[model samples]
Target: MRRHRRAKIVATVGPASAAPDKLRALFLAGVDTFRLNFSHGLQEDHARVHAAIRALEQEVGRPIGILQDLQGPKIRIGTVKDGRLDLTAGETVRFVLDGSEGDKQAIPLCHPEIFAAAAPGQDLLIDDGRIRVRVVGLDADTLTAEVITGGPVSNRKGVNLPGTLLDLSPLTPKDRADLAFGLELGVDWVALSFVQKPSDVVEARALIGNRAGILSKIEKPQALERIGDIIRLSDAVMVARGDLGVEIPHEDVPGRQKELIRACRLAAKPVVVATQMLDSMVAAPAPTRAEASDVATAIYDGADAVMLSAESATGQYPVEAVTMMDRIIRSVEGHKLYRSIIATSDPGEEETPPHAVASATATLAEAVQASAIVTYTTSGTTTARVARKRPAVPILALTPHLATARRLCLMWGAHSVHTDDVDSYEEMTTKAADCAVQEEFARSSDLIVTTAGIPFQMAGNTNNIRVIQIQ
Candidate 1:
């Protein structure tokens, strides 16, 4: 199905939607990108999903982007003999690095990296911030914390150390293995989780080494302090709000999401707003009114894509969740407020000559009422520049590289197609106009604005723009 809206949808694949038929249905429903969450499923599970996506892409004649999200350093408490501990508030709990029985006295908290960084007065959020603990004392290989708010503390519950930047590599051993597996599987994007600073991104980039696009998942409060540096360093960014809400106050998530999206747009990097967008749809066929409004808010804030986590991955109503999210996005995009939001949003920092030239293509297209803005690019930056413009018209991005075409699925307002390299300017214009007509984005004699570099093979050399009539 053809989507009129520019913003994309990313749906996570899991047991509920791993079948080939279900995946195909989701693709036809409006899932522009498929996310293989590396946290849950096994390598074989992802292989099946990846194969299904490839088959669907072949059948649909469109490029689909697969994002493999690496599970970073996830710290959790060790298990007890009786399986659970009901600790009272204002009681002391000993977090020792030993395989001892976990009772009211002390449990095994084996992550020494966190303990090394532990200090007095630091808050330790356990089990998604459900249980709050404050560090009172630190000894050799042990941390004594006072339970500020206590509940049933179970085994393997997650631990979040807010306001404390631990000296830990973002990628654990599992993440490295998963990254190698995902690269072998040929995924388009790799999302690094829990990035705290620019150095984290640089380290991950060194490992990724241009094999795929590296997307930084912003879930830690420390990442926000250096967000601009992170945004500029990574190819894309994901506003991973699940842990972000835990790290920061719940009331601050909305503003932080907007800030991150704006930062990505300023750098022309695609940003995805993720986690609990349509939470109610996980169990019910319809989403709550608040859920609908939440999604609309993301779209209005000019995010390139909105993601569904449990709502699509393991929900009882996976298809229904995807359908509802698709409808909500379409409805919001068609609203009068959507265009006003795009028009009033930041115009982006156009630094280079190609950038300035690409920015003008939008205004010219709107003035002339062109059917589409056609971009012939080598590195996909030209189309990304146009996408940030949020023109009233659609963008047709033609590239010779299949990887570029697949990665463009995350871009707002970009419809990328793989084609042969253009030898001259005339070939570029012809391909752009032909694609506009063939794709039915425009008709005969319809005006099309085409932009590309002079030497077609050279990357980041977009320096020309032309208005052509489709023959």
Candidate 2:
């Protein structure tokens, strides 16, 4: 289907939208990619969803993207006495490193990594920061902390230690297994959660290789410290704002979001703004005004895509949420100030032949008011570069590789078509014109800008651009 807007929508699959018919409805409603969250479901459940998506792709005659989200290390307090404990503000509490049940005196914290990394004076946020505590003292067996914010500390509530860098790999044994399964299932993208350093991405890259794109989730405070290196190492990035908000100050999230989007644009990598974009849609048919503004803000900042988590997963209005997100993007892109705003934030091209050609292609397309900017790609580099420019016209990416086409679905303004390889200049232009017409990108006599490599099918060799008028 042709999307009037440039930004894409990624929807998570869950019980609310896991049926084949529901999946098809979501695709028709404007979902560009499907994210399978491994944190909540069984392996069999995810496998079923993956199979259904592939089946839907075949039926629609379009390349659909599948993203496997690995559940990283989960740190939480062990079971509490009577399943709950309340610590009032300013009260002293002790967290012991044992698996036994706990009371107001000694709560069980089973993870030793937190103890090893944590120290006096650092704040410990529990249960999504509802219950805050400041570390007063620590020993090999226990951490003595004073409750900063009083609240009930439930059994196994998640623990967040802001500013403390734990010596742990983002990947757990479960994540490794999930990664292997996703790779075997032919997912287009793998999103690694809890990424703290560049080495975390490197470790995932070692396992992923060229099988799928590695998308780092920038939800850790440590990740923000080395974002540039992390972005350089990752194929793509996601602003997972849920856990991110808990780990960092909420006021700083917006600035960090803008910074990430700009960095990804400058690097020509896709970035997805996720979490609670339409959160209220989980129960209500329409989202709150602030939530609508949140989605629009990301589009205005030039995010490649905005994602739906519980809104599309277990929400009551999955299709409605997708439709609303689609409308929000179209509205933002059609705003009078959109063009100027995007251009203002545009990162100028790098000093290289490919970058120069890509930048020129966008400039030339706008200058000539072309119908579309068509790119021939094998590994999607040329298309990504063209998209980074955020050209006025839509990007029609023609690729012979289905994997490449599927992966490009996550990029901004990129409409990927799986076509046969073109061998020569004559054939390339002919195919470009044909696909443009068949895909309804342009009508007869309309002009289009086409880009490709000289060696024909070689990857990462973007060296040519031509403006062709449909016959």
Candidate 3:
């Protein structure tokens, strides 16, 4: 199916929408990618979903991106006494390594690394910042903290320390196993959660290597300090605002989101703005006005894609949520101001081969008013570069590698199609133009611009650009 707008949509798979037909409906509803949350289902369950997605890809004759989100390090308070305990302001609570049920005096914190790295005066926020405490002291066996914003602390509630950089890797044992499964399934993208430094990306990259794209989920406060380096190191970035909002104030999320989108755009990296875009649809058939506005805001801000988490995973109206989001994106993009807003962020002044070719493609397409810009890619880099320009026309990325086409789904204005390798320039144009026509992006006699390397056998050698009119 064809999308009218530039930005893409990501629908998460869960029990609510796991059927083969249901997933196919989601793809028809404009879901460019499917996110399998490892935090929820079993390996077997995700394997089923993965197989189902590949089946749909074959049936529809398209490249559908599969993103496996890893459940990163788990920092939480252990079991609480009486099932839960309430702490009052001015009261001190002890977090011990030994798991035990206790009263208001001490709670269980089994993670020894947290106690080791945690220092005095560091604030600890639990349950998404509902209960706040400040680490007053730390010893070999315990972490003494004072209740600053007291509330009910339950068993295994998430702990967020915005101050200190906890000594932890972005992956766990479960994540390692999940990574293996995802790679084996030919997953397109692997989202690393709770990324702190560039090393996190390096660590995950070392394991994933060239098998998949590493998308750093920026949700930790430490990540913000070195966001540029992380973006440079990562293949892509996702503004995972769910945890980010907890680590920082709600007011700061919007600014951070804008900053990240702009940074990624400048760096020519695909970025996804995720978390609660259409949250109300989880229960209601229609989204709240605020949620609708939120989706529009991401589109107008030039995000590559807006994600639907629980809304599509377990919502009462999964199809409606995606349809509504699609409508919102088209409506906002249809506005006369859409291109003007996007034009304000001009392409950078870089003379690199990729940048130069991408810039020329955009300029040439605009000059001729080409029906579309056709890109033959093997690693999705050329498509990403062209997307950063935000051309007025749609970008048709034709890739021989299914994974490359699938990974391009998260880029703005890119419509990916899997096609055979082009042995010559003549064959490349003919195949790309044919795929475009089949995709209904352009009709006969329509003007189009095609880009690729001279030696079709070589990669990243995009030194050629041509304009063609369909016969």
Q: Whole-model Cα lDDT per candidate?
A: 0.90, 0.94, 0.88
Residue-level lDDT tens digits of model 3 in 105-173: 568878878887788999989999999999998898878888999878888899988856888989999
Residue 272, candidate 2: Cα error in Å is: 0.5
Stretches > 4 Å off in candidate 3: none
Top lDDT model? 2
Ranking by TM-score: 2, 1, 3
Q: Give the TM-score of candidate 1.
A: 0.98
In model 3, what lDDT does residue 267 have?
Answer: 87
Model 1: residues >4 Å from true position, as ranges?
none
* Worst ten in a row by lDDT for model 1: 97-106
Instruction: After superposing candidate 2 on the true structure, give the runs of residues whose Cα lies further than 4 Å from its correct spot.
Output: none
RMSD of 1: 1.1
* Tens-digit per-residue lDDT, 1-471, candidate 2: 888889999999999999999999999999999999999899899999999999999999999999999989978998888898989999999999985789877899888998898889999999989999999999888999999999888888999999778888989999999999999999999999999999999999999999999999999999999999999999899999989999888999999999999999999999999999999999999999999999999999999999999999999999999999999999999999999999999977688889888989999998999999999999999999999999889999999999999999899999999999878888999999999999999998899999988888788889999999999
- Name the lDDT value of residue 353 in candidate 2: 88
Selected candidate, larger lDDT, 2 vs 3:
2
Candidate 3 has what TM-score?
0.97
Task: For candidate 1, write residues 1-471 as lDDT tens digits.
Answer: 457788999999988888999999888888999999988989999998999899999999999999999989989889975889987899898888776667766788989887888899999999999999999998878899999999998889999998778888989999999999999989999999999999999998888888899999999999999998999989999999999999899999999998998889888999999999999888888999999999999999899999999888889999889888889888988997778887888756568888788888888999899999999988888899888887888999999998999999999999989898878888778888888888889998899998888877888787888999888
